[model samples]
Target chain A: MKKNILEISSFSNEKLKYISGLKEKKNREKSGTFFIEGFREIQRAQISGKVKFEYILTCPDCYLGENEEDLVSSIDAKTILVPKQIFEKISYRDRPDGLIATAELPDFSLSSKTKLSDDPILVIEGVEKPGNLGTILRTAEGAGFHKVFVADPRLDLFNPNVIRSSTGTLFTLDVFQSDIKELYPILKNAGYKTFAVTPEAKSLHWDADLKGKVALVFGSEQYGLSEYARSQSDQYISLPMKGVADSLNLAMSAGILMYEVLRQKSQIDN
Target chain B: MKKNILEISSFSNEKLKYISGLKEKKNREKSGTFFIEGFREIQRAQISGKVKFEYILTCPDCYLGENEEDLVSSIDAKTILVPKQIFEKISYRDRPDGLIATAELPDFSLSSKTKLSDDPILVIEGVEKPGNLGTILRTAEGAGFHKVFVADPRLDLFNPNVIRSSTGTLFTLDVFQSDIKELYPILKNAGYKTFAVTPEAKSLHWDADLKGKVALVFGSEQYGLSEYARSQSDQYISLPMKGVADSLNLAMSAGILMYEVLRQKSQIDN
Candidate 1:
């Protein structure tokens, strides 16, 4: 394991300042780096080999055990030991788990030969909430989708909050940043049917032909799918609402779409 | 509008103490009350008539305008103005939005004919996160699920966090607490298929018959479905996982199952 080097005493430590500033979207973009907190998430990042860690910060009293230390060693990150109070000040959670990592963002790009199976591909547009984006990524990964393309990813994928909300699946999945305008041609050329998930659509999600190579598009909660995204799609589908609530959360909508694809693919495979 | 009665100055105010205590489940249970912050949420609660408020606390500077005051006045809640700092102390969110309502918990009980429709029901077992519960409720409401039977709900229904996460859908849906054992016979007699959602299940979610009246069961992240809940289920179904991740979040799983049912029912209807 990497030996502890720096003893961070203040929140204004250069690294600490950089990490705290990453909580905002602009800072993350400018730095080309982000933070992932908690032991489990950092371990996942280490195992995935996609993240390049600059350093790890931990409390002296509750340092990572040998097994965890071994995992951290493989990633080649510098280690720092800090007081518990210092750790707490930098933590986003109510209880800091005494472990945090600063890692280089994964350089992701969509594959030229996009795999279009019978299962539907999830296309997220302008998803604002980090938790919602992370949950959708976790769901997309779990449902066995080949790719989860973020068409205009609003939040940083490597945000500590996103990593926590995703339960570390963000470390494993294929996530790319692109807009609907750029992605539309690729989807259409691939012969995949595109379905924009919206509330105002006349047909229900089930009515759509989800069994084919499909790209299921979802938009922001405040505004549904953009006009451009909707126009480019082959079909528009919606979840039926029997209650007074106007719309479902973006992540939930994506989850429903992913599962519908799962359901259809399973039937065809069988 | 209800006239502002007290200008809260101290942190030790009885009302502030009560609202702050809601951070713990035990306190909420003992007091039979919880906090609901945000203007839209409080407005929804008032419109639903599910919760009776003891008081509405807000910063005087951020208090509603005369037009907004007219809307608040009709709610019949006792209004109180507090310093922004005092309001911030008791508020869970970073920005309080100048509204926090102390609301008595609704007496939630399963209806005798709890089967609201031939469409599916969602049964969540031992879900620990209020955000997950709220997201599931939002999805259930959007998917046109007849009722959501929260089996062994770990968090209180009136949790301010849940209300916020749900985007006010909690006010418009039928949410109640009951045991899995209590629900089994009723679901069976109603000719509903009870599908326990697990990663180890033999059948994929799509391969299962979700068209009829169905009850999709989900469990906590730490534990899969409870032994009792698993035993009582008619069958177990899983979403296919291609990635290294074993499972999706509880709310995501519920969303997928809910939408799958919607898809099936729509096909049949069409």
Candidate 2:
């Protein structure tokens, strides 16, 4: 056992209760902390230095991989050892990796304290599913997007599903959440050409000059960009719909649009 | 009740047992029928005229939409009426639209009878998740690809999640599934330059000549294309991974690559 490790014997321990409490949005808000599970997610969070984890729970016995002990020793936070049963009780995953940590939620508001970037930004509006938001973040990273902003999100930004699906890019990327009113000014001041994605748009996505600084907005398939979002956006662009499916999945839309920006900027066009 | 409608009140009714039993893959294969839910999905399946629905279960009591009776009226299949409790019992969705149908699974094997499209083909290899397959189908439709072939799929072709996530594109799109050996010859004979998508590949996807007849194969992120798949492909191509994320989500990768093919072919490139 590590120097800081303390074994958790009972299921009803306060740490176990606290770790599970972050599952609820209200508890996370009140406590100002959310939970991070999985080995890769914690490592990314640690390297990013954007958020602080108060402590972590590790069940070496339940671990699937050989590196759990090494990762525990590397982090600056306190580590609490756990039995397999107790770890499984607090875990969100079907196959637990034997690591769970309570992390202080970063301030996602567009305040002066927040670091803004010149790299192409991806914005999602009213994302209804955590999986969609997580995927967009991962896609955004793959497409070289440095920053992402969510406007009027339906799911909590720190939802564990988001972290799980993102494969930890949620920590590596600059993720911010704010309402529509708070969103546009930052992009405008940053001199970003905001492209509002809609199926009804006149300009096809590839037709738009996505080069230079830009922010791409994706909305729900059922209800597109809010009236306010449409109004704030500089251009209305759409992916070409050739077959019966009128809209691509929300994450898929983000992937296509984000890459289009990269494709235009990379001097690799036709 | 309509002329062919039968009310199912008892939970132990054979009709109810039979409906719920299709959840298992063996049952779906044995009975050769899978379930679909949602109004928009059913409407699309009806219009596609490809697969045949054996029957539909409807709960007028639990209906959130006003158009259930009208949709039930249009289909030729027998309608089984159920109370709210029974509808919820057999439902895969959190909120059932009061419509669930057992549609005969179309033979997905690539045989001489299979319809081939000159349009760009999208093939997924060893897909581990139904959601990824479903999203790829939806994206393929939006990107104008008419046919989708799955090779060595881990999940069943007609998995309920695939149907749910595809939003009934499963019916509208010509879907075929076969082993890796059965796949290559069809593409080879069709004169397609198969682009095998792997992160390790030298040629970027956009840089590839996606013009005319092409088949793009996306593999699992953890496991790239099987040895036979790599050996069979005409070109190994990759999406530019610019940031910390080593790979995009399987569906997102499909979305990006599918759009790239469309982007190059449509004369929309820079």
Candidate 3:
């Protein structure tokens, strides 16, 4: 809610060029910054205090709902007020709430989340879809898993779809990319058993001894767990696929497993 | 494989006009037939033999994988071969597999799925998104629930998104629409315990006794189970939302609860 306001109506503006360039993954990697488009999402990222914002873009005319200005006022960042047409051109959402914040990508390193949970260490490998990745983070957060490690990510962690699908839970959770090969040794050193979810596995998730510290590993929906992922596991677990479903979507698979982990922990606690 | 192939290339063709017009919800409603685009999905619908196919449109050059011709040859219906451009124009997929089948909407009434399972009855109510509906059908099938009763559906059963997201499992299950009011009485008469899922519900799904004949009821993601859905339910149950997640996605919610029902049954079976 700083007093210094910068208005950029021209599409060719330098700051506008940099903002639109962020839609590309290469630019995000180069800048080490990503944009969160909704006021609710931006507020979540701001509240987490993990990310440092450079600026916020607002189009008061294009806003869909309440208190968007309040969010703009709350965050200590340069504010850009553009016309509705200029704002819509930059917006990714169908019904945007007219606030977008650009923030420095915080560390998703597994090191940032050590000692966060005694529950299952949730690690996702070679995730190809941003929606799945985002949904996984949301599911992990919802199930009370503190940190989710992304190993060999095919998509960027801050893909707008990931932010949207996670409903801004991305900021609340410790989600970072690490190599799957490197991840297992650390998990093992930390006295954790690793369970890779694969369709080939004979073990049902229900039968697995998740009462102890464990890591639930998953691969892309297109490819089940990698050969390395399967080989490194302490056990192989699977959900039942009875009729026509070849496999569950990655996020759905993660949800079922995370809740199973939660359920087992609740049994112990109660 | 039946070989009744009728080739049509012109976009202005009368039959092609009908196929493209079905893209509109109004056209689909007027004709009482919906189009499912994808080779795998058409094959499932053909194999299910529950709905009568009106015709199929295919473009061999546009197919991404094998067996397009085999599917066209198997179904005993009129086939029209078009160029890649015509197929792409009608396809909702980013990567089209070049098969679109038109079929009359099948009966979605609970009576249609009668005697399908002694397992927990699966009932989805007031679902707004086609993707969620499709995923719910896939989850029900995977968890070994034979029939999925979609009550008061907000979207058509055979929406392209539903067909695609379900991975063609829509054809393999008994999916039908009926009012929520009508569903429970029939379920009650059939000795099924109806558990409506809502966030306001005090009982957790894990703690709920689901061993007996039961029905898991779900509402739209935006609005939890409707008042009729909640009040009519024998008990209201909720999935845990530990972090910032307001609620689980409709499909993910269904997946967790269906698996929970499956887990309890597995215990008794052992």
Candidate 4:
């Protein structure tokens, strides 16, 4: 396949500006697109076959895989070539992997037949940190969760940091963007118990029946689970903290809770 | 109690340079001190009473405490009166809380008779990310682990990000640093069934006997557990990934494993 490498010399280049604007949640939603950078992340996106690649931009020396080429051909996106220096300027990290791909948001709908087994679901509410969100997605995937529904996510789901932090797991997971009101009904209808994780909760997390089809709810680090979300939850559960710390990080809580679900499921299966 | 407010107007302030340098691990070790910023974190340090506070710098308008005069009189440290602008410059976060305290590193050594439960211990190896390290500490503390030991930590425990991420639990928990080789004797002596968490591991995480006195080891995100660490382990355990993503983040894995330990213990306890 013949490739056209377009050198992005100016930061004012329309494409560069568009990609840069994606760092903001508003811009990503406005364009109905998000940017996923780095060679590894782009490769994961391609392998997942969920996101539609608008274009793949990389330095002259970078290799584009056959799958990537097929994706480019299928989407009719011109593989824009970027100078190394220009790519560095647009990259998020200190060292640019020399690859960035603009991808259309995957069309995701919460499955009506969402399986609620002994394994619990992880529900995130208003998670602000991109890295925390990404880490949670990666953890959920590792803990055997098939779906992660973001209820009123404060940051853009496709933020480059989120992509990098998730180690590209975000590309493969079922990530739904909706308000708690929208998600609560679906979870309830699916017969999934919702447990809101909070410091003020009287019951310890271990005391909760995590073996059931459950959705573990967490909020931002600052305000914790929102009052509305907390009120809507089936129960409030907390980790047993003997130390001086008040609460765990959003991702850590999700990881602990998801694994609890897995542990319970394994015991049941045995 | 008369409080002296030191207003640091110049960037050339030696104290400012010293505090900023604490951001690096080398500088922190060389100086034998680290800075904890923000009101809540500083309060946590005071409550834990693990680390000695060398000094407290804050704006007059900032709430020191209800008995501000009494609290200031109690500590034998010089109080610096800084303008909000000056504090903002020294602060790491965007909104400076007008409080930064220099703290001596706490002696985090485990006691000879440190209680070892039938549950597992988390040994974090070469985790570079402060947030990841902090999250792991928070989870370990929350999950009621016998103890958490940092095996070749890449980032200093006193890094502001680690302090913030752990919600100041770093000060209260039994967190000590050691190389991977040092853990083998300790595990053997303590009768811990050693398990290394790695993607290459054939045994699933659930397959391990987490209810026993197990020591679960994890490495950096960039590099999986060192070959030596892997070789020393009795068994290798990995989370079952149903998706295309190959690995989970280090902290997330730690959190999940910690909870698994908690789940097993809870089951046995009940």
Candidate 3 lDDT, A51-142, residue by residue in tens: 89988999999887778888889888889999988888888877777898888888777663455355577999999899888888888888
The residue pairs found clashing in candidate 2 are none
Taking the tens digit of each residue's C-alpha lDDT, what string does model 1 give over B64-109? 4444455556667777777888888888886567777877888777
Q: Which window of ten consecutive residues has the lowest lDDT sum in model 4 chain B? A: B63-72
TM-score (C-alpha) between model 1 and the true structure: 0.82
The DockQ of each candidate is 0.63, 0.86, 0.71, 0.56
Q: TM-score of A-chain in each prediction?
A: 0.88, 0.93, 0.94, 0.85
Q: What is the TM-score of each candidate against the true structure?
A: 0.82, 0.95, 0.93, 0.86
* Error of model 4, residue B145, in angstroms: 3.2
Cα lDDT tens digits, model 3, B1-270, are 656678887889999989888867899889999888887788888888887888899988988888877778777778888899988988888888889988888766666446635767788888888888888877888898876788888887767788888877888877767888877788888888899888778899999999979899998876768888877888999998898766877888899999999999999999
DockQ of 2: 0.86
Instruction: Report how closely model 4 matches the true complex, as a DockQ value.
Output: 0.56
Docking class of 2: high
In terms of DockQ, which candidate is stronger, 2 or 4?
2
* Model 1 misplaced stretches (Cα beyond 4 Å): A1-31, A38-40, A43-49, A57-70, A79-99, A109-120, A189-192, A211-213, B1-31, B47-49, B56-71, B80-99, B109-119, B180-193, B211-213
C-alpha displacement of B36 in model 2, angstroms?
1.4
- Candidate 2's displacement at residue B29, Å, is 3.1
For all candidates in order, the CA lDDT equals: 0.77, 0.85, 0.84, 0.76
Best by TM-score: 2
Worst 10 residues of 1 chain A by lDDT: A60-69
> Comparing only chain A of model 4 with the true chain A, what is the TM-score?
0.85
Greater-lDDT candidate between 2 and 3: 2
TM-score pick, better of 1 and 3: 3
